[model samples]
Target: MNKEDVSFEIFPPDFVLEPYHVFRKNALANRNRTESQEVDHDMDILYQFWSHFLVRNFNAQMYNEFRSLALDDDFSTRNASTGLHRLIQFYGASLSRNSVMPDQVVRDLVDLIRDEATTRAEHVAFYLLRSAWRSGSLDPRNREKIDSVLDAHMTAELEK
Candidate 1:
């Protein structure tokens, strides 16, 4: 992402932004050699990592900007695609009967994307929740909370 475009916005060090910046990379990378790829795979992973941290810190500007970027059709599917694949699989096992992703893990991840419910990028919270539900990994105690979150998201969308 270009620093000039986001010059109006707050930013961390260049090294930090290199992996997670998404605001102004050339929308058409192949079309423009001068432009950096719109979405960086490393950036996606970093974003997902930050998403976890954002759960506690909750920076509206940063979160909103990144999430808005994530909603785009070209936000790099690998953000949601490859990220946390090995991590989750290792921690929670596969989505099969022996799957071990904790209910709270599922719940928190769902909550992670509560504001941007429809995004398919970086951590793919919706998909994670679905996989847990299908695998019977989610505990009954947190089911209502997850449902409520999704229900509220749907309601907001319908109203919009």
Candidate 2:
């Protein structure tokens, strides 16, 4: 994805504190990433933190980094699955940027899922990503452009 293709908006400075930017936000995101044990208050905080940290500052470069990390040849199934969940959660929170991801990204995600997904957790993450991205990325307004590549991975699984 190119800079011109970035659809998410740049966040305002008031939303982030310089002293605790990456460390603080990452801690929050990693903390809330789960399915069970949610109260309304916690969900609200989760939504707020997600929007504040990820959706507002989302861009092609971030997507590229995620793509590179997840598609890394030796990325473990656990990593791929967890990574895909993170991507989907980002997608769910950004209801306005449905088509931001490229087709190849979708294919890469799917290819990785099919190839590396061995655990139920991994499959669950893939299922959610597929469902959310395919349905709309939480945005019913714009059409999403996601696809999958079946069979063996195009590139050989590189040595770690």
Candidate 3:
């Protein structure tokens, strides 16, 4: 091949190098970069992480964002193109099977039920209950009160 052709040819980096060496270099670079960036941009990085955490912690946000894409809505394809739909589906399935409910997540769920039920809380509660139900941890014997609250909240939402 001509030099230009050779230069333009795409080769998978991992295929050409010892995987460990490539991985070690990448890991070292990533660690150094993150450390330096964290020191210089602490608030910016923290805010970014916190925003991601909130979007994930608030089940209503999670469900609305995902369901909007999973359904045949106008932006479904565009949303799916962002890969969030798959991510949400995987996360939802994992939550359903693992019986893992973080303390913060539960607290947010409760807050939604008590404070935002008529407005934003309603949607969040719906998503939270669905996640809990999927995890098989939302059984009547264990979470009856919360379940009842969610049911009532959902009923209210539907009526609107």
Candidate 4:
């Protein structure tokens, strides 16, 4: 599909982060209390938006901008990190349901898990594995690599 076929326009980072901020605020307010259905609904909308964006831009340059947001240290706070992880998850899940993910995206996610020592890394790794599994895109060798890294991460966490 060409750029013209895409129905949605890519928004600036600030615009993209607006829903995330709203969801984060709701989550923070709901902590230690019963979860609000409204928060869940908001998150669902956010995920849908992200999923659509990923699917439409899977082959476009906008993917690089999205990936940059996911890996950006400026957006690495706890809530932002969680939002990034969910965005990646939605993207991967969409690819799994429709088409194969690009090799570079897989490699970048694996590298993120390998180099980053954060919960976001683990979450991304898990979603990547799920996406690969569902899409039948992961070969045995790549599966082994991801498994090894996840195993090491789990072992470290257990030791701690």
lDDT of 4 by residue, 120-155 (tens): 435555545555655566566555444554556543
Candidate 3 Cα misplacement greater than 4 A, ranges: 1-95, 121-160
Clashes of 1: 3
Best by TM-score: 4
Instruction: Residues 132-152, candidate 1: write the lDDT tens digits.
Output: 666566565555445654665
TM-scores for every predicted model: 0.34, 0.38, 0.27, 0.42
Candidate 1: residue 37 lDDT (0-100): 37
Error of 4 at 134 (Å): 9.1
> What lDDT is obtained when candidate 2 is compared to the true structure?
0.44
- Between prediction 3 and prediction 4, which has the larger lDDT? 4
Residue 59 lDDT in candidate 3: 59
- Ranked candidates (TM-score, high to low): 4, 2, 1, 3
For residues 1-160, could you state the per-residue lDDT of candidate 2 as single tens digits?
A: 7745864467663554334456445644653464433323332343444433555665555566554433341134323234444555654454345435445445555555555465444464355554554454444432233322443332222110
* Candidate 2 C-alpha error for residue 153, in Å: 15
For TM-score, candidate 1 versus 3, the one ahead is 1
Ranking by lDDT: 4, 2, 1, 3
Better of 1 and 2 by TM-score: 2
- Ten residues in sequence with the least summed lDDT for candidate 1: 26-35
* Backbone clashes counted, model 4: 0
